[model samples]
Target: MAEEGQVIACHDLRVWHGQIRKGYESNKLIVVYLTAPWCVPCKFMAPVVDELAKKFTNVMFLKVDVDVKQLKYVPIDFGVDCGVESMPTFVFLKNDVVLDKLVGADKVKLEQLTERHATIVVYFTASWYGPCKFMAPVVDELAKKFTNVVFVKVDVDELKSKAVDFGVDSMPTFIFLKGGDVVVKLVGADDKVKLERLTETHATL
Candidate 1:
């Protein structure tokens, strides 16, 4: 068993399949750290990833030693099409979807990516709406400022059903979701402070 905030190493094929499947099925964000023992860059980023695992307790960090002969076919089966071709490739996944990928030992990008996908904030907006246009920059700024929260901008015109499902009548509506459930809903473009405050609140939770 893995200690709190530590990366769970995938040395066994069955154990690896279980971890990936469970994490995806539950809508939890997962970071697959693909590495090999002889790779110097992987060595450099191992500690960095470990620290991130500790920082983002909500995110699952899984380490895969590519050199393990028994785990040779794991990457191909991991849904990272074409398998992992680079050392220290970080694949960010949620609900079996590849949200993002990073190659090499770029510590800053690694942390930023991990934090960005840890939590979600769905921003519902319409392109034709003036208020939505006004709030676009504000939302972008908030996303940049709050690295730990993901900002999903959905256009009402494009996804009318989604907007209706969220009960969004306004041009801009911010829905804070935890584990696919709505925790907070803000309907307006006038209050940037409230938006940022709420983002900070739900993100840290």
Candidate 2:
């Protein structure tokens, strides 16, 4: 099954900070949005943030209200780190450390930033397919080589429902997923070296 994306609202300062500390890991990206209730641009950008949250399951999407007078650090904690000089600032972090920042409601930049951090691979196969059996070892080797990327194998016969969910109509189809989106699709059991090259090209970017 595909992982679902989420957006968490921060109502408390220390509790949200602690939660972020616990959830922040190397394999996932943390996206913190600094917004305010009175800012028109922030209000307009709210839906975009929600959409990004749904699209990027590997990202931790957080929304913080700067005007909420109740919280202390939630409003101004990472102003410098995130370079938040304005409302609706987007902060991207990795391993609890700031990696990138974006200002305003730019949908294109948001998608680009999310793509840069997500890494995943999905293989769709069936027992009746001979090429799928041949490609099993290559997939296993890829799982070992790309430790940072998630590798998934779906049996078309065993999980017919899931295969339909992923829109898989053929056997031995390989899907390259990033930020909960399919970036590439292959219909046959391609060569092992080409698979590695594909993974490397995406992983490094």
**Candidate 2, 204: how far from true, in Å?**
13
Identify the candidate with maximal TM-score.
2
Compared with the true structure, all predictions reach lDDT values of 0.80, 0.72
Writing each residue's lDDT as its tens digit, candidate 2 over 67-167 gives 66665465466663223447678888767667788888787887787666657677888878899999998888876665445566888888899778878
For residues 1-205, write the lDDT of model 1, one tens digit per residue: 8864789999988878888887765456889998988888888998998998787755788999877888877666654433344787889887777888898889999987876667878899888889888999998888667654667789888899998898888878988877557889999888989998998887555
Cα RMSD (angstroms) for every candidate in the order listed? 11.6, 7.7
TM-score for candidate 1, please give it.
Answer: 0.57
In model 1, where do residues sit more than 4 Å from their true spots? 77-85, 120-205
lDDT of 1: 0.80
* lDDT for position 134 in model 1: 91
- Could you tell me how far off, in angstroms, the CA of residue 2 lies in candidate 1 after the best superposition? 0.5
CA lDDT of 37 in candidate 1?
84
